[model samples]
Target: MIEVRNLTKRYGPLTVVDDLSFTVQAGQVTGFLGPNGAGKTTTMRMIVGLAAPDRGSVTVSGRRYADIAVPLSEVGALLDAGAVHGGRTAYDHLWALAASNGLPRRRVGEVLARTGMASVAAKRAGGFSLGMRQRLGIAAALLGDPRVLIFDEPVNGLDPEGIRWVRELMRSLAAEGRAVLVSSHLMSEMAQTADHLVVIGRGRLIADTSMSEFMRSAGEGTVHVRAADPGALALRLSAAGAGVREGLESSLVVSGMTAGDVGRIAAYHGLALSELTPQRASLEDAFMELTAGSVDYQGVTS
Candidate 1:
C-alpha cells in the first residue's frame, strides 16, 4: 500500500499541491484523476521521490521510497515512457535497470514476454513507435516484480487491443494483492478498470471514494418511464415531488426519484407501465460535474 499524508509542493510562490492526502490500498486499482495543470504529475513525482515535498510524507508499505534498500523491487513507476535512451535495445535497457537494482538478468526476459515485447527485445528503443515505447516502459516497470505500481497515462498511445491489455494487466496486478495507482484522462477506460478513485482539482482533493459511490453521488439520478397514460403518470409523479419532463415516444423523464420508487408509485396507483429504465451516470459525466469549477482552462463553446 501507498500512503500520502499532508503532501504539499510549491514553485515561486505558486502552490501546486495543497496538503493532499490519500491511500492506495492493496488488492484494488485506484485511479488518479484531475484536470490539466491540477498538480497530478507533481504529486506523483513526490511519491516516487523524484521531487521533494514542501510538507508531508509519502510511504510505500511502511518506509519512504528513498529509504528502501531495493526501491525498484518495492515500487515500480512509469512516469515518462519516452525517458529511455534511444540507442539502447529493449533488452539492453531492461538489463541496465536490473543491474542497477541487483535484480537477476532473467527478470528482464520475463517482463519482456509479459509486456508482449519479447519479439522486439533486440530492437533499439529509438525506432519504436509511441505504442511500442509505452509497452517497453511498462516492461521496465514490471522488471523488478514490484509489489506496488504507479503508471501515469499507461495507455496514452495504445491501440484498442493495447488499451485492453493494459487494463487487464493493471487488474491482474491488483488481484495479486499489489497496490496499483494509475493516472489517466480516459474516463471510459478508467470506468472499466478502476475499482476506486482519487480525484483532484487545482491541487486539492475533490473525491476519494469507491467508483460506485463516486458515480452515485456526483449527479442526480434520472429515470425513464413510459406508461399507457403518460399524462396521468406524469401528473402523479409530479404530485409525488418528482420533476417530470416529456420524453420521446410518450415517455417521461423523471428526476428526484429512483427507478424503484417510480415503479412502486406506479404500482400503488394501479398505472399500466410499458417500460421503466434507470439511466446510470457515466464516469465522464461525473468527472465533468464534480470538477466543473476547478477547470483551469475553459474553451469558449458557441
Candidate 2:
C-alpha cells in the first residue's frame, strides 16, 4: 500500500499539484487520471521522489522511497520509455537495474521471460520499437520484483495487442497483492484495467473512488429500447411523463424511467419490443463528463 499526504507542489507562481492526498491499496490497480498539464506526472514524480513536493510526502508501504533500503525490492517504476541505455541490450539493461539493488542476475532473465522479451533480450534497446522498449522497461521494473509498481503511461505508443498485454500485466500484478498505480490519459484502457480511480484536475484531487462506484455515480440512468413502433412508443412514453427520443434505427432512448418500467409500459400498450436494456455510459464518457468543467486546458477545435 502507498499513502500520499497533503502532496502539494508549486513552481514559483504556478502550482502543479495542490494538497493531494490518497491511499493506493494493495490488490487493486488504482488509476491516476487527469488531462494533460493536470499535474499527474508531477504528482507521480513526487511520489517516487523524483520531485519533492512543497507541502507533503509520499510513502510506499510504510516509509519514504528514499529512506527505504533496497528500494528496488520495495517499489518498481517505469516512468519513461527512454530510461535505458541506447547501446545496451534489453537483458543488459535489466541486469543493471538488478545490480543496482543487489538483485540476482537471474532476475534479469526471469523478468525478460515473464515480459515475453526473451527473444529480443539480446536486441539493442535503441533499435527496439516503442512497444519493445516498453516491455524492456517493464522487465527492468520487475527485475527487483518489488511489492509496489508504478507505471506512468505504460501503454503510450503501444499498438492494440501490446496495450492488452500491458493491461493484463497490471491486473496480474494487482492480483498478486502488489499495489499498482498507473497514470494514463487513455480512459478506455483504464476502464478495463483499473479497479480504483483517483481523478485529478488542475493538480487537485477531484474524485477518489472505486471504478464501479465512480461509474455508477457519473453514469446517469437511461433506458435503451428498440421497438417496431418507434413513433408510437416515443409518443406514448412521452405522454406518460417518460422523456423518450429516437436512439437508433427503430430504437428509443428513454430517461427518467427504468428499463423494467419501460418494458412494462410497452407491454401495457401492446407494443412489440426488441431490445430493452439500461444504457450505461462508457467509462471514457463518464470521465469526460465528470472532469469536463475541471479541465485546465482545452484542445483548440479549430
How big is the positional error of residue 295 in model 2, measured in Å on the Cα after superposition? 1.4
- Models 1 onward score TM values of 0.86, 0.90
lDDT to native, each model:
0.94, 0.89
State the lDDT of candidate 1 residue by residue for 191-293, as single tens digits.
9999999999989999999999998786766899999898999999999999999988888999889999999999999999989999877899899989999
In model 2, which regions exceed 4 Å deviation?
245-250, 299-302
Candidate 2 vs. truth: CA RMSD? 2.3
- Compute the lDDT of residue 284 as modeled in candidate 2: 84
Stretches of model 1 off by over 4 angstroms after superposition = 224-254, 257-276
Instruction: Per model, state how many residue pairs clash.
Output: 0, 0
- Can you write out model 2's per-residue Cα lDDT over 2-64, one digit (the tens) per residue? 999999999999999999999999999999998888888898888789998899889999899
Cα TM-score of candidate 2: 0.90
